[model samples]
Target: MSRRHLAMLTATVLAAASLTACGSGDEPGDGGKTLTYWASNQGASLEADKEILQPELDKFEQQTGIKVNVEVVPWSDLLNRLLAAATTGQGPDVVNIGNTWSASLQATGALVEFDDATLDKVGGKDRFVPAALAAAGAPDKPPAAVPLYSLAYALYYNKQSFADAGITAPPTTWEEMAEAGRKLTGDGKWGLAVEGANPSENAHHAFTFAQQYGGEWFDAAGKPTFDTPQNVAAVKRYVDLMAVDKIVNPSNAEYAQNQSVSDFANGKAAMLLWQAAGANLKSQNMAADAYGVAPVPFLANPPAGGKQVNSMVAGINIAVFKHTKNLDGALEFVKFMTSDTEQVTLNKTYGSLPAVGTVAADPAFAADEQKVLAQTLATTAAPLPQVPEESTFETLVGTAIKELFADAASGRPVTEDSVREKLTRAQQQMR
Candidate 1:
């Protein structure tokens, strides 16, 4: 299963009381010393998350003398629960947010923006991975959150399947990938597993493919560029895997990201586009030697200066609700969570990359997949556009791809004109 790299929620209004409540250290019913934290579930289950995090919380409390209340919220509920709390001027002192939502949430004025002085308290901005920190918020403003954990997408292929098909190496260009896919498809199996039903997963792929084809999602002024000719071509190319190239299974239109990963792990498909799928694949009893990792394939005929790119720097970020009464303690906890010790411990257990650069030296991250992701992060990967409407972009663009997938699956014509129509509607809607 794909890890919950980001869980975008609809932005909501913060209560009137929240404006003054934040950073004030003044609330009526509770003492300011106790800090409340809403942690995203990081382990197999909510209970498992609690077990993993409580010991760390205990250590923090012992050192700081601040009582900490912890709640493990499932991904489905975390956003709405935060909305409810913000509406009531009552929420956790610190909480986890999808890094991509930082800009959207920042627009609501609900999260604390870390300034130079406050950032200094957390060991300065130099401690974090540059690409990871860049995803926290916009370039011109203080970031609404700081990266907590990180991830990048990679190509995961079935080694035995490749050997059986007589392919000695993973394809480096899109043309070679298509050729390899054609050769790998047969005997009741597919060459590639695609996640058509999962909108976010589709959106992530759109970003990578569009970028590879020299298509930008937003113009210089940050206006929607959804229907551009280049983007249309990119979307068509992706859909062609099923509709034209016939390398992917048409039935895969029903697959979500998890189902796609399952297909690859179970030998129903030869290749998968995924991030940090190791732990989940292991859970499904897949052997380590069965699969191999490679950089995501790029375009064979990229425009001048264009190079292969993979994913937006994806991960969760930790933010403080600006309205928390225990201002000092909340800030302290933020520092503690992003500290070197905790970053290593949490990311190690979660099967994710650490936000802090120094922590990457740990042996736990020395796997081949981790190395490829690390190289990509340092070289070609980028964050989602740091615009206030990034979440909307994800929703609108993802839905467009979903519509295309539906057409291909149902035997409807997926013409360039139809692609433009869907994309234009999504673009105009964004206006």
Candidate 2:
């Protein structure tokens, strides 16, 4: 299937905590004649996605007279395929990847540097959210990948839970959120929601919370910064919500991408923290008019210099592999995919918050739900550190946080100092 389809299906089938990378080159393709490009499981399968995406591919063939040999690999297999290809130079000519992979993949020197002039031929940075583009960039270098689509974290709440808790509206601060959560708890329901198992989601959510608490994951040099005073303090405070506050779901110890969203959607929880509100709510077919989405709650006491950092910014990025024999043809395909025309088509076929600024303004993503998302991506965005060590750090931090939550769920006394000690252990591994 297509990448978008894979994204949705993977939500139900795969744990959000994953390590799927694309474009390995360890072994070669069947015959070296075709420009074999591999992509992720966007929908049902490669063949299924071809129904929507293959037409686009066909158009490219007609326009450029370049035949693309396409392979659809499951997200589960993407990392292995890319590793194989990277080792053997047998990766695809074009690939779509999670924004988080930019740092790790780039560090291996497996991809080529993105050129500004060339990117302009594709969709320019002006077309995408600054932070989304930034995620695909080097610390001080220009972006390496062209974002194909984007998402931003927002607060999705169950109206029933809010009403039951006597909450007129969603909480506006972490302290107030805790109070609301407690009120919503009991009666076989959870107040707050989480993706505890998946570091892909957890680390970002933690980072977003850290921003509100005035924390940074990496220092100026892009080294591990989880041990920073602010980060440590923020993490301890966050973990306490489940461990000490007792407002979160105990089962959250193993949540992933859409799990929390599912909780809120099904009315099992009061709130879900995530990006891609509309797509994730999975409420498209269901009549969830009772659902309400809003910006993340602000911190009660503002950090000295930190603004209210709400949600993590994320997106799908498009990159042209260096080894594609059809350089000019591949370039044309890239331009077509990112162009305003293609963006419009993509939004309809697979609904995502679009990456291009103009397309975001289009009527397709026009509902109040989508409007707020676009705004978040444009203004509230804070790019996660674009460094290779980031994913590794997330895995370490996530495990500790999960343990803390488990302790809290069992009514154990969890302390900031204890979390700090855990951070120390994580720091050692990260380094």
Candidate 3:
């Protein structure tokens, strides 16, 4: 996270528990127990989150006679604030966190233990995506946090580019994708926008390919396997897209997570892999009619044993602080946030899908594009490692991966040995 984000988060921790920020012995009806809330910016605009939530908080206040003070934090500031709050014991009453961060934050003992009671309040464990809840909640236990929504990935390619290239269909296999890429590469165009400098994207593509190649990042127990030959070969092919094949662009040296999306949107790239939000299809910015969705391209003749895995999963969960002075108030708010009606409303307005299957299955939410994202999540998503150490690489590893791919693309002589050495070193650092 950036220093500015960390600073803002630190301020939030102070505001949440500083007897002053909660409102000094004010003249409120109650003796002043302001349940401070800190949330992420996943809801598009911060104003939107308030417009949707203020009514709920107002309702909660009216019904239960409790006051809630809320502050919206951007994604970058979330971890910093959480870290500050956790270390100081003066944070928001409730926190909205990335599901993948459960292990890291849980380690700090900053959150309450999820239980049968909360499970029922949040529509039960069965209500959420199994993979999501697995990542959101504590392992070997019910989730400490309730599922909010999922951010899913898909292949978003340029229809015009595909047409101009005389390609009528998207590739279903890695081989076909490569062949199609070769067909599409010419002049100023390239087949794929592979950023070897982006470790995060590389990691994501690695996971996506490992499935298509029939391997995974970890066994059932959650261990590193990126160095394995399947993954190594998978990484090789991704590198080869730039190295040997030369179907990827050189701009990838500077590409980040969603950089390729811009390239595809602007027609500079024929294919771009990214997290897809169908709700944005009709927006003025997106080429909705010119694009379509598909499961990621797979391997043609898997080495006879690889599995076809889909995209990785990401989302936020609401967690109650373990040390909140007001448990009753916190639980009350939790119930309000996870209610069936609340789920529908939040998903519709936030572009986030309901955590529970029932909520998505509801006639009310059926119209929302977020529901489609949720369905894609249910059947195809792979859970990223819940370990916090992985979160540390959100940027660093991505930078490394992007550089590695870019270096190879420029014929600067990056080799598997060098990349693997770094990756292996990273895994060891986690330990």
Q: What is the lDDT of every predicted structure here?
A: 0.79, 0.67, 0.66
lDDT tens digits, residue span 1-431, model 1: 00111223323323223322123234355467677788886554678778889999999989988867788886545655655554455667898987876886676677788988878877799988877888888888888888998888888999988998899999988788899999999989999999887666777788788888788888888888999888888888888888887788888887754677778878999998887777667766788778999988888888754546767777889998878776678888988998988988887777688998888899988888888888887777877777777766777788788889889989998999998998899888777
Q: On residues 1-431, what C-alpha lDDT tens digit does candidate 3 reach at each position? A: 23333343356656665433232123355554568788776543566556667887888788877888888776545675676777676667888887766766776667887787767664566776676677775466556687776577666666777888888998887778788888889888888765455555577776676676766656666555556666666766677777777778877866643456556656666876665444433332664567766666667778766765667786778898876777767877877787777778776665566776666667655542444456667677777666544455343334445666767756776567766765566555434
- Candidate 2, residues 280-367: lDDT per residue as tens digits? 3543343447778787787888778666667666777777666555555566776777778788887545546766777666878877
For residue 294, give model 2's deviation from the true position in Å. Answer: 0.2
Top candidate on TM-score is 1
How far off is model 1, as Cα RMSD?
5.2
In order of appearance, the predictions have TM-scores of: 0.86, 0.81, 0.77
- The residue ranges of model 1 lying beyond 4 angstroms of the native Cα positions read 1-36, 40-51, 61-90, 304-307
TM-score of 1: 0.86
Off by over 4 Å in 3: 1-33, 43-72, 129-131, 182-202, 218-223, 239-249, 256-259, 280-284, 349-352, 363-378, 386-399, 406-411
Winner by lDDT: 1
